[model samples]
Target: MVQYNEWMKDVNDDAKLSSLSVPGTHNSAACHVALPSVQCQGASVTDQLNHGVRFLDIRCAKLFLASGDDANDLQVIHGKFPVKIPFPLKLAKVLDEVYAFLQSHGSETVIVSLKQEGQDTWDNDSDEFPKVIWENYVRPHQDQWYLGSGIPRLGDTRGKAVLFRRFGVKDEQLSQNLGIDAHWWTYNTTDDDRGEIRVQDFCELNDTNDVQKKSDYVKQLTSQAIQYNATNPADPKLFLNFCSGSNFFNPECWPEKIAQCMSDANIQDCFGKGCGIVVLDYSEKDDYKLVKELVDKNF
Candidate 1:
């Protein structure tokens, strides 16, 4: 029951820990152990003076350099949603890890909160929209660029990323001191400059002629590279599933198509693309089921 709220309390915490990551602690030749870290909220803090440290942030982390005015300030870290601990020990360990982690990353503020209802908070990534655009638009550009011009395709590096999680929260009046929003968690790929093709985009009313044209173009491009093909990827009767939507979610709508495509392409990690895939299951103190459904539906 150490009240780490007292800054001094953290002094005697881990002696060998204090100089951690410093020249005294981290030697290039030093043999670091393989133990995992204890994450406070989502940040990994030091436990027993650091043998290991890392946590799964939103798979597609919103990585932008810190801005001015706040430039001197640490990158403020806050949950876009919420997370909670059923056990005190678990929470305490995470706190310990977060403390150590702050120094490692220049993050200024780290907020822990409870999950909320009716908000979009998941990243269901798939390849339909961009596939449509790429097959039709980008491919043509590539061909023309190669044939008689000089232009660079920016690729998917535009930072159009995604993140998603399922969690719960309690319902209460705002002023009641309810510990609801204090621990919400989310990995933010919130917006995009790159035209990130979303799952919803695939549902848009595309012209039948355009779809056929693009489909035909795709067939021509991959025909020699891939001898086999699937035209009606999503024939109403089939259902497909995967552990992740990868960096996007449009694929969920036509799961069978993706599975078939992956098998054809011989991808090692079919759903593991973009940043990295991690499923974090944390909750708040409230109606678990209802909150989760609301969050899932809205997000």
Candidate 2:
């Protein structure tokens, strides 16, 4: 039996990372938040990794502490005050989990799509943000992180969190454009979508109660992903399709509900060959069935 955690170890290293079907979690650390719409995940980082989720969508903010010292650490945040994480210790805890997982599973690599949020007091200072990230997070643990921009080989990034920075850059040298915007779009941005690894964030639920309509949208996107990946088998590209949504007014379009739509057996069958990296919400529930299906497709 294949180990649930180290499934990526079986993937061929010669193949480009972009070509493989990786399961990602959007707002991966939002499990602790109390709000309805912003909470995208239900599992901790270690649990998600153990469940075969190779990609992680992390949103962070630089928070200033009250001790006259700014604790340059990254705090996970979704929206403004209400949806933000309560304390700074959470980031440390999460990183500890990531480090432990990678140390044990040297053959697997994780992708962290990092974006900045919340009120940044250092907006006036151009170099502070990147410096904070470098000094606090990336520099001390440089060996454990894959800091490059372009898609990397699986072997090179093994046992590391390949940083995909989505935050603003003051120091270009800090990330080397590795943290480029993920090119997230709605349902109609199909024309401009062209890349070796394409991503679509079509989680807009106009009508919160319309479950059937949301399901149809998810099905349509998955079908398109199948066709997109099939176009070039020899040199396949990634299709990051998001199965997450939010509606402040109606809890029906919450992250869990959106994930349920993607959980259908018919939808899972669409990725029999592969579905690139399917980012989901509320992935900790349902025994991580959706993520397991994606990982199984890799082998």
Estimate every model's Cα lDDT from 0 to 1. 0.21, 0.69
Tens digits of per-residue lDDT for model 1, 104-140:
4321112221112222222324422223222432244
**264-290 per-residue lDDT for model 2 (tens digits):** 534566664466677788887679887
Clashes by residue pair, model 2: 165-179
Give all candidate RMSDs, comma-separated: 22.8, 3.1
TM-score on alpha carbons, each prediction: 0.19, 0.85
Task: For model 2, state the Cα shift of residue 240 in Å.
Answer: 1.6
| TM-score top scorer | 2
In model 2, the Cα lDDT at residue 78 comes to 75
